[model samples]
Target chain A: MAQSNFDRRRINGPEESFQPTFEDDDDRETRWKPGNPRIGRGARDIRPIFLTAGLINQANGSAYIETEKTKIACAVYGPRQSKSTTYNEKGRLNVEVKFSPFSCTRRRVPIRDAEDRSVAVQIQQALVPAVRLELLPKSTIDIFITIIENDGIEGCIAAGSVAASAALADAGIEMLGLVASCSAAVVGKEIWLDPTEEEGKASSGTLILAGMPALGTITSVWQSGSMTPADGIKCMEACQERYTDIHAVIAQSLLDNAQNNT
Target chain B: MAAVLLSKSERAYIQSSLKATPPLRADGRGLLDFRTVLLETGVAPLANGSARLNIGKMAREGGGGTEIVAAAKLEVEDVESGDGVDGGRVACSVTCSPAAYPHLSSNALDELQHDLSVILQQTIGHPSLHPRNLTIIPRKKSWLLNLDAVVLADAGNVVDALFMAARAALWDAKVPRTRAVQYRAPEALKSAKNDVPGAMDVDEGTSGFDTRDMARTAADFELPDYWDEGETLDGREKWPVCVTLNLLTPRHFLDATPAEEASVPQRLHLMFSFVPSAPPTLQAMRLLGPEELDLKDLKESIAFGEQYAKELFTALETKLREEDNRRNIKARDRFALMR
Candidate 1:
């Protein structure tokens, strides 16, 4: 079946959409042969990030983060009474990631698509280890992320984990440490950290890693594509190196918000 | 996959027993051992290739073993319209039989299906897959292989069974050979048409080919009537298979039962290509559970997963070959009887 499930609640876009074709298509294929510098930046550099917490008025806690062209807003709903009829010992953590219809090159449907659900699962796994669900038994913490703009799938997921974790901290939930995530595209022999959609198109492999920088523990690892063991380790290590920086951004913003409240 | 439930006493017994060196699994298998798997290919007659696998049960009529049926189907379409950004692609979906898993909520079942399908889809996107071989016409037409699986039963480590069945199905899958390909309109490649076993069915002059603009061309291809003469998917043997390692702290084991899974604090699922090398290509890896994995365990799990994947691939290869031989013998016997 070709997309049998559509969101009847909202007016849908066309069933098919195509990426715009360019004039210089023939020569473009040979443009990215290894060892050449990326179009605008060094391979090791990531887009400058802007992050903050506690923005939403109705939600328990909220955070918004922007990285170049990508924008993500996250909100944490509750650790209050769960709606489940059955009894649960350890609290439940639910993560939902949604991309706006116009967020990516192709128009996403109003309903949750596979890309959004996959990212949501990754974010939940990344933050589960850090969230002390047992302390809030019989309750559930729901995390929702809205992507206004998506630069790359891997980048969006890594950023979503960071934003979700920061929002959880802002909600005053007890936790081990913040989960900082980063991703990179393995293009040729080089590793481009926090690759954008354009850079990601030519890469052979992609890796997104989430870790607790303070606790020095890995919370989640989602990697795909083809790569040697050495390259996989290299990509993982590259991601680990940047977590402290990303964590610092989240931690500093949280500190700034706390001081302003006082 | 909803979490299996166990009593505190059972959990404690399993945890304490498994934490020791040379950990004793509930099934009495060694650390690097796999549960017995019984698989039969060509189980689905209409599909290109299919396999039904039963793990944790030796008797065919047994009731408790985890069972799964996997099928790989192929369809040809224009490359630009295909969902794949690079080349031909594999689309995977899984559904858990409610008869087997009555306890799982609808939401849990949806989530489980998505996760299982993602692992299969991403693993097949490995560079070694060589999807370009699916090209019927360069940059124009390619094959899209749709892989679907049904989890009939989940004994314990059902994901392993699912992965094995999928790999075997693709292993036995065949691609229809394009005897002749006519790229756009009236200019049918006359030279390539005479060698085919079937009469050519070409759509005449729907559009004409312009040598100056070959990029926007459409292709018409015909498959031979004899399906057995078809070719296998390119680089089928090098495709990766998943090996899930359950960590009970201090020691890890190959396949964990439902009771054993409930006691385990963490699991590491690694997908490795069955290439014969010191370190096989790591197609994909994911960590599941509530605790952080130690570096030692992560490293050990990779090496362990690689070794295990190779062995498992070997076992599957032999099984497929044996099944082929059996089919050939039966076909020959029928031919002699008819003659």
Candidate 2:
């Protein structure tokens, strides 16, 4: 992985259009419904994605992504010798997640809590299948994800994977294919794609998955709460459908960088 | 990691830079121009009274390279014994955290704190405006004002920067009103005697009253009913400013930036107050350097520091008073709500 110096220059910008919400609002009875007119909609509101490649100068590769409301930064370090020698046949990947002290409304304490650790583990599980770890034996590539700001869990893990993959590619790390991740929540019988914080909280079920479109392989699978196996299959299908849009974004981010460098 | 060593030539170049300019250095201002100082109070949301000051950033002309931030925290405490007969005391501590220089020693912090304390004690605690006046209750309790100064970034001339921050923080500090409730004592109640309604005064021809007893009664019973009013009192504490003098070669600078500081061999720090309408008060003074300064240098530095100290105090007072007026207007709006 090659470290990029551009990341350090972009600090948290002036506060505007940032909203803080507590709890999810995705239940069937909730006054606000997903895709409702009250929520408003636009490419500017939902698109206008800000993406940057090669930020962490010390890391092999790094990228920062900011959607309408969410901001995620990822850095990939190494391909260096692995610390744990036991996994000698295949290379290893480790993921770490961090939130800035001022990332949230309330001061975020430095200590990593159970929730954060779980997210890190889940993210690692999601990306493992997409990365070609066996290409470099006895080596390890570390991914550090820092959530500068969070809007909603919708597309967060997928966004994180895209950032991680871009950073890894920038570092010149070999990968079987790019993995894209996204999530959907089932609130009551209704399936909501890209649930906001309010919707995610009210959701009775959540499905997070990652897959390599080129290879047609599912790299990660995660489900929480209660959802039928049929519902799970439906959500995965929806995710695959969403992948086309996410793939374009990942592709454009790299293309823009290539053009800028040229 | 091997330490990056400074060669002899590098040290000599730095020393030569110090001598390149004569007294009343390059900016054409006197030895005490003090670079344009900008002070703003109540900047820190969390602190009681926080201040951010930029000292000497103007000297860079258009470069805009140097900047410093100093914040002050003011806290109140009870007056301790042996601190005169005053019921309360105010402690002002200033910490300069230079973003440019992160690894500062504890000794440096202590030196800055001591200088600030002196300046505050002298001007704010002048003999006429005694700190004891701030005491709501005598002997038993008093308000102790604690001021903490923090330096957010270091541009140059931290002493001036620190002083500005300290002054702003002090202005921002609001000494809460202290109220005391005292129940009437049984003995005091017993001392009250009822006078007959519509009773006539005694004269020489009638029943006589002793003149000596009348005098004693007058002395003991005057305003006896409102004795409690005098028992508890509240007032504002005085404000003070810290002054630092940097000795560069044979020339003396009032506030020196980090670059200028690195060139200087010694520093003389003093905390003093001059209330223009009143006599100057000297609180604390210290000469910081490996080498000792002669009495003449000490006296000259003191004079130079005192002159700037007065100017800083006036500027701070005006700024604080303006803030107080703004607050009063807001308070009046709040009072309107009660009706």
Candidate 1 residue-wise lDDT, B30-121, digit = tens: 87777788899889988888899988884565567889999989878776666543357677888888776788878888878888888777
Candidate 2 lDDT, B7-51, residue by residue in tens: 557556655655565543434556566667666656766655566
Q: Model 1: clashing residue pairs?
A: none
CA-based DockQ, model 1: 0.65
Tally clashes: model 2.
21
* Interface C-alpha root-mean-square deviation, candidates in order: 1.9, 34.9
What would the per-residue lDDT of candidate 2 be over residues A1-262, giving only the tens digit for each residue?
A: 1132224444633433333666765654747655543243421123346778878788888899887667899999988898865656668788888876666665555555433554665577666766777788999888999988876654566678778878877788877777766777666666766666666676655666576666665555555444544555567677767765676777788777768879
Error of 2 at A23 (Å): 68
Candidate 1 residue A230 C-alpha distance from true site, Å: 2.1
Docking class of 2: incorrect
Give candidate 2 regions above 4 Å deviation. Answer: A1-262, B1-31, B44-48, B57-86, B94-100, B104-130, B184-238, B325-339
